[model samples]
Target chain A: MRFIDDFRNAEHVKALAGSIERRAAQAGRPLRFMEVCGGHTMAIHRFGLPQLLPESVELLSGPGCPVCVTPTTYIDRAIELGRDGALLTTFGDLYRVPGSERSVEGASAAGLLEALVVYSPRDALRAAQDSHDREVVFLAIGFETTAPTVAATLLEAKRLGLRNFRVLSGHKTMPRALRALLEAPEVAIDGFILPGHVCTITGARPFTFIPDEFGVPCCVTGFEPADILASIEKLTELCGPGRRPALENAYRRAVRPDGNEKALALLERVMVPVDAQWRGIGHIPGSGLDLGPQWLEFRVEPPDPERPSAEYSACRCGDVLRGLIKPAECSLFGEVCTPDSPVGPCMVSSEGSCAAHFKYGSQTFTAGLAEIAENGKGY
Target chain B: MTEKTIKLGHGSGGSLTRALIEETLLRYFDSPLLAGLPDSAKVQLQGVPAAFTTDTYVVDPLFFPGGDIGKLAVYGTVNDLAVVGAIPRFISCALIIEEGLPQSDLRTILSSMRQAADHAGTEVVTGDTKVVPRGKADSIFINTAGIGAFRPESALPDAEMKAGDVVLVSGPIGDHGAAVLSAREGLNLDSAILSDCAPVTEVAQAILAGARRTSFLRDVTRGGLVTILNEAVGGAPLGLLLREQDIPVRPGVRSICELLGLDPFYLACEGRVAAVIDAESAPIVVEAVRRTPAGQDATIIGEATAEYAGEIVIETAFGTHRLVQMLSGEQLPRIC
Candidate 1:
């Protein structure tokens, strides 16, 4: 608790909160800041940061949850691989995610497929090594923070000449998605709180475009109460009238301007950028990662296009992810799309904004009900 | 449409498990005792109040740091009975052994069970065993059923729980979960954490003997403290407000949870007990609990509240609050 307890100091958080309130008052307008990372989303809600910030300072969620953004087609492909007698492996976030037809968890539970949840890509590689007679396909999905590990695992597989190991990549880059969000007609985010973990790999340099081109102040943020509050304070200070938009690094403790070079090099050697489809958001060109030519032998085939995919037109995840509305504002947020029977990936993935809202921020919606019940009109 | 089959989450002791019980199992077994679904069933035998509980251990590796499956089986059942205000006196063990299991491993497990039973002051009055083919079972699976006489002076009824009641935890949590996970061969890190798989009988007994009014008591096990607390306020028009800083968690467990993107609140603990007592007697109960060896870390974690009914809200260090929902499924590691 050395580093953790220190960052969560109440005194520091209170000071930062007071500073943010002062800065927002000086700005003389309602400030809308978007935190473009699932970790930030969870941390903000987990610590109930909104209660600390002034009502004028509204925080919006962006397309930062990797599992939420992963296209259902990718999951369909993994299920196909499992159905073809291959052992499917993936992160637990993707286990219950409803694909086009059925999720990997559903397929496995029905005895139609064999699947396992691996904490890391190397665990999937180990499964491949352990099961020599069968093919092991890792349902690779994540952002840059997780891609390097998958890249390293592929390199290791190549070094050992493991033939049965395969990967279906759904990895995506973050900075480009931010660019798309800014360019969207409906989104009016005044500033951005960058993802700390992804920035640790890609560094703060990739996100400079948000401020330099879009004139929105951005800060690379950490996932602590004080860290987030400090970032908010910094972004608010920079957003003052007559102040030029700039990028800041409040998470310098773990991130660098240049990022982890070794990981960048790993991505360069074994992976390449490609056009990929985001689940709620539509296609974003050159926003995805795939195995490079040298590692193509380890790649799994694309999903079958003919597979019947369920349409979730009623899900307002796209609007929620785009910062146009809060999760509670979505009609199907609680009663219709609870975590147990999620109507969209946003409700299924733990880091998704809806899941975070439902789990940690539902007091806003339920407080009224509780008040009514306390008035003696029993629920 | 998703197929209806027994998924792994059904055994996770979370929402899916509750659904399986309410939607399926309860349909066949409709008795009120089973319907209430307390850790142990309360009944009267020969006009004497008693508690009965059973648990099965299928923890992989069979053995882990600081404890093994055998000890877990005995302690798990005894703690269930103990928390229900009963004096654990008799337990029965049943084993389903894989054919290829080594004799030494079996001996080690059985001997640990015997030692655990003796330490808890309970007797294995009757038992059964069966050998299955190699693939039929894991290395070994142990099931234990216990019986205990109700302590008339310390009968903490569920209906007695109300707003303003204080909640106290016996010790740090998540050690058992972290230790078992570390014992597996993956995510490559050498951990020194040990499973807190000892008996919570002392802690439970201490609280009961000290508290002027004890309303509810539960052994924090499979679903951890959050799940237990959620169950405490499930149907009641009450909520719990927990101080995040007050919850005791070991540094090692916290580090492991951080690395894996897991919440320590949802992690399992085998040797901890959470009790809901009258607000006036909380300090006295904490003092009494600290007198026990296993309860040295005891502290008041939270208190029931009339606001935010049917929810558990945790107040953070920054004076902000959030709702702590019952875990929908297993606490899986997140992908960054």
Candidate 2:
């Protein structure tokens, strides 16, 4: 906890918060910063950072939760394979996410599929190795932080000549997604709080475009409270009057300018970028990673295209993910959708914007607001 | 549609397990004692009140750092009795052994149980054993039923907690959970982590002695500290406000939790107890607990409140408040 505890110091956090408040006041205008990682979103809520921020500064949660961004098509295909006698293995977060008709957990509960929750891609590989007769499909999800491990697993499967092992990848890259967010005309984001873990693998170079092309100051920040406060202060300074937008690494302890060379090489060797369909935002060109030609045989694709996909018609998860609306604005938010019985991906993934808001924000903020109204004081 | 079947979540002791109990088992066993749903049931035997509790051990990898399944069975039952302000006296153990289990393994397990019971100052006086087909069961499973004399002056009911009660945990959270997980995953965290799997009878006794009136006392077992608090506040006009920074989690356990994408609040602690006492008596209770071996790390973690009645919330280290809901299912690792 050496490195972690240092960034979570209460004294340092208070100092950073004071500086951020002063800087925001000096800017003399509303500023909106978007954090483009589910981890960052969770951290902001977990630390209750929003309450500490100046009223004029708004933080938008981007479409960064991999499970939330993964379209229903991927889950449907995975379920179909699961029902067809394949031993489906997936990360825990994906198990509860609803597909077109049913979630993998619902399918497993109903005895249609034999799904297993695994800690790593290697666990899936071990399952495939253990059960030689059944095909094992690992649901590959997440951004750069997870892609390299899946790539290495595929290489190991090849080295072992394991024919039963396969992957249904909905893997996405962070840079293109960030670029897509920037290209949106409706969003008025002033700066970006980049993902630290993702940057640890892909480096800060991929995010330099945000500052250079969009004139949006970007800071690769860690997840701790002080790290986030420090990053916000840095972004405020960068976006100050007469200051040029630049990409900075606030999480220099973990991330570097060039990133992890070995992880990048592994990902490049095993996968290629493709046009992937995001749940709310439609298709983002070259945002998705698919298996390369060498690993194509291990890819599991949907068996049918004509099948009608089930939709949660009343859910406003797409709008929520895009920061077009808050989770409270969704009609079905706490009533029809909850963590126990989530109607959409946003409520299913632990890091999903809706889940974070519902779990941490809605009730607490409302109660705090009521207290403030009664006492004429701010918390 | 797939046919419904049993899953691992059923045994996780979280919301899912509670649902299973309410939907299936509770219907058939609707006695007043069972309905109370205390860790141990109070029974009147010939006009004298006694505590009766039963628990089954089904932990994977029978042997783990600090303790094994047999030790856990003994300590788990003894702790359950102790938390209810009972002087644990006797226990009955029932063993279900698979056909192919080695004699040496069985001997080791039995000896461990004997040592644990002796350490707790309790006697496993009566026992039964049964053998099953090789594939019918795991290597071994032990079920223990304990009987203890109730300390009438110190008895703390499960629903006795009130607003302004201070919550204190006997030691660091998640050590037992992390240790077990490490042993299962072969993570080599054994160098830094060890299971806090022991009886906390002495700590419970000291807490009862120090507090003028003990509102609640529960061993943080399967469902962990948060789950226990959630259960304690369920349907009651009470709320628990815990301080995240005040919660003592071992550095090794914290690292393991980070590695597994788990919250230590929901991790099981076999040896730890979560108690609620009146605000005025909190200082005395903490002093008394700190003097005991099992409670040396004890600290006041939170206080009960009327705000957000029937809810559990935590003031995070960042000075923000967040609701701590009972975990719905198993804590599985995330891809990220």
Candidate 3:
């Protein structure tokens, strides 16, 4: 708890909150800050940072959750492989997430799929090694933080000559996705709290375009309460009237400006950037990473053309992901779409905006709204 | 409708398990006694009120850092009976052993079970054993059913929880879960973590003695504390408000949870007991619980609230509040 306890210190948090308030007051106008990582979304809600921030500073949840951004088609295809007599493995979060028609759980319940939750790609390899008769397909879905491990796993599989293993890669690159969001006309993001873990891999250089091109301040911050608050403070000062937009690294301890060279090299050797389809957001060019040609045989095939595509017409996940609307604004938010029976990935993924709002933000917001109605202020 | 096959989540003892009980199992066996869904079934047997509870243990690896499946099987049933304010007296064990299991391993398991029963002061008077083919079952599976005499003078009803009641948890959460997970996954952490698997009978007795009214007592087992609270307030005109900072979680367990991307609140604890007591008597009950061996880490974690009825709200250390939902599906380790 060396790093963790220090970040959650009550005295430090209070002092930071006071400084953030002062910075927000100096800005005068309302400021919108978006943290583009599922980890950040969860941390912000877990620490209840929104209530501590000034009313003029609004935090918007962007498409940061890898599981939330993964398209339903990917889940559908993974389930299809499981039904076709292949052993499927994925991180636990994907087990209950709904595809167009069925989830991995639903498919397993129907006795058509044999799926297991593995903590890492190595575990998936071990499962394949343990079962010689069945082919094991690992559903690889994550950002840069996890893709390097998957790359290493692929390399090891090749070195070990393990032909029974394959990967269904849904791995995405965060920089391009962030670029897409910044370019979106509907999104009114004032500044960005860049993903700290991803920045640790690809480094702060990838995010320079955000400030230089779009004139939006960006801060690479850790997931701790203090890191988030300090990043918000930096963004507030940078967003001041006369200050030039800049990219600052508030999470300097973990993230270097150049990032991990070995991880970047490993990604370069095993994978290439491709046009990837995000679940709610449409396809962004060169946003997804696919296994290199040497690993193509290990790639799970696409879904059959005859299978009907499923869509949640009632869900506003796309709007929510684009920061066009808050999760509560969605019509199916808490009523029909809940954590138990999620109508959208936003409600299903722990990092998704809807899940964070439903679990932490909504009730707190309601309580704050009630207090404001009575006393004219939330805090 | 086509019958849906069982999934692992149905056995996770979380929201899915509750749904299975209420939606499928309870539908077939509808009765007032079954409707209560207490940890143990309360029944009058030959003019004597008794608490009867049964539990099955299918833990992997058979043995863990602090205890094995045998001890878990024994203490699990005894604790279930004890939480109902009963004096656990008799236990019946029925084990399903696989054919290829080693004889020496069987002896070790049985010996551990005997020691655990002795420690809890309960008698395993009757037992049954069956051997299945190698592929049919795991190495071994244990089923224990316990019976305890319920004294009317000290009866603690499960449905007696009211608004403003105090919630107390005996000892830290997630020790058993983290220990088992680490042992299974081979996580060689810097510190050694052990399972908190023991009978909570003494803690329960002390709590009942000190509290003016003990509303309910639940062993935080497979679904951990949050699930138990959710079940405790199901459909009731009350909610639970917990302070995140007050909840006791060991540093090692916290580190493991952080590394694995899991929540300690949803992790399992075999020995801990979550109790609801009258607000005024919380201090006395906490003191009483502290005197017991199992309740050395006892503290008031939260209180029953009228706001957000049937929901559990946690006031985070950062001065924000969030809802603690029941564990849905398995507590799978997150990738990111």
Candidate 4:
């Protein structure tokens, strides 16, 4: 509660909003910043941070949600493992993620397979240890924030000599994906609100490329409202026409400049970067993580390639992830594709841009926002 | 195509479960009493007005901090009857025990059930038990059907809701959910947070006694406060605007929700009651509820609104409105 309550203090948030408004006035230009973390996206919408920002400042969500950006092919592979009688275990976020034909949850619902939602990789390891007769496949899907734990779990599995334990990994790195978003012609991002959780592992250096290469201001941000507002305030100050681009660590309390060395070492030992397929974005070099040579035996891959892939031709999730369009810009966002029956991964994952927008951003009370800002009390 | 079968989400008390009852179950059982779909069905037994309800408990882990499944089974049914303005009198319990369950554990659960019934001032009149193979069931499952006599001038209907009505919640939300989840996952959250799995009969009775016009009353169980409100507003040309800061959530529960990236509003509460009272008697009802120990934390969370008909929205701490949709699928832990 220390960090949460203090950070969400209405007085502090109002002060930061005042500072951001002043900075926005001084900049005299539209501030288009992309929040490159799904946590940031969710916090922005959940806390209604957009309403606090000045009219000139706009925040766009990037490919931040790990479950949303995961290619359906990986989900297909995990579902296939479940169908092959493997007791599949995965993060709860991936349990309902549609995988081409169906999800692991759908398979379990149909009585075709067994799947469990585990909070961490260690739980999946425990499941494997508990079930001796059935093969337990951990569907590993996440960004750097989760990769170290998966690496440690894999090492533990090897140490225990568990023959039934395996992992279907869809782990991905962030810096490369951020670069891909920048290189696109349609996206015109001026600054970035970096993912604080990932930076706690990979550190601030990995994201310096955004400023050095593309002249975009970057701020590693936390999930709290004040943390995000402070990051936006800093980004606003640095994004003025005459100002030079810079990388600021707004979430220095949690993240270090160099990151967690022990976790990085674990990732280096057990995992290797590979060209991976993203859901909306195409394959990116060295973006995905796969088991290293020593850990190959613990890996699970799709048995066949000619399986059904996701039918997402109508879903503008790609545009939404790239900051090219809002979720409402898509035809199937709220009507046909909703949280109940999601048509794409964006609508499925709570952290996905579309889902966040749909869940919290679809409606706003104009009177409430103006009234609160005027009184300086309601917030 | 995969054949449809029951999924875990169907038991989550969210939209899927709502659909299961409204779309599938209702189609087969074509009775007006069942069609109303209140927590308890209104009925007349031998020329006396009565309320009847049934619920099944299959909570995993059987035991948790503050309360276990047995206490939950009894309190859940009794609360259902109490919310419908009924004084619970009799309850029928059925147990499905799995083989290999320890006798000591069974005795402990059974004793807890008896104690809970005693505390609620209800009697377990009839019961049944069956044993299944070791893998057929999780430790034990309990189902309970309750019957209560409706007091004269105590029938609260859903349509009684209107704009300007006050919504009050009895104590904090998400305690039971956060307690159970942290206990199951070994999250070691602040130990002060415990399951609020007590009977809401006292709180409900307080509202009925004090408020001149109590429009709606529901024990916030599965799907948390938001889901219950959505159900409360079903097909009614009314909206609810809840002040996010006004809703009571314990610090420990809020911390756990923050850690898991889950919304506390969507978390379940086994003992909390959400009620709508007429605008004139709202303050009187709150004062009356606060006099009771169980309702000490009771306060006005929101009010029914004419704007955004057929919807519920929460005004965030920043004073921006966010549409509160029914719990879709399940509130799963996020993959950070």
Calculate candidate 4's fnat. Answer: 0.74
Off by over 4 Å in 3: A302-309, A361-363, A366-379, B1-3, B152-163
Q: What are the lDDT figures for the candidates, one per model?
A: 0.86, 0.85, 0.87, 0.86
- For all predictions, the C-alpha RMSD in Å is 2.4, 2.8, 2.7, 3.4
Q: What is candidate 4's lDDT per residue for B30-93, written digit by digit as tens?
A: 8899876889998987788899999999987788888999999999999999999888889998
- By lDDT rank, best first, the candidates go 3, 1, 4, 2
The residue pairs that clash in candidate 4, if any, are none
Cα error, residue B331 of model 1, in Å, equals 1.0
Query: Per-residue alpha-carbon lDDT of model 3 for A1-379, expressed as tens digits?
Result: 9889999988899889999899888888999999889999998887788878888998988889999988888898898888888999989888888887878988888888889889999999999999886899999999999999999999899998898999998899999998998888888999999999999999999999999999999999999999999999999999776899999999999999999999999999999887788888877888888888778878876443233335588889988888888887787887898787799989998778888887764545555646635743221
Each candidate's clash count: 0, 2, 0, 0
Q: List the residue pairs that clash in candidate 3.
A: none
Q: Provide the TM-score for each candidate, comma-separated.
A: 0.96, 0.94, 0.95, 0.95
Tell me how each candidate scores on DockQ against the true complex.
0.75, 0.57, 0.64, 0.67
Q: What are the runs in model 4 whose C-alpha is more than 4 Å off?
A: A302-309, A363-379, B153-159
Query: Candidate 4 at residue B191, lDDT?
Result: 56
lDDT of 2 by residue, B1-336 (tens): 545556667778888788888988899999988995888998999999999999999888898888899999999999999998898999999999999999999999999999999999899999999999998999998999999997766645444777888998999998888889898888885356888998899899988878876777899999788888787788877888999999999989999987787889999999999988888988888988989878899999999998757778888666767877788778877767
Task: In model 3, state the lDDT of residue B157.
Answer: 43
Which lDDT value does model 2 have at A208? 93
Look at candidate 4 and tell me the lDDT of residue A105.
87
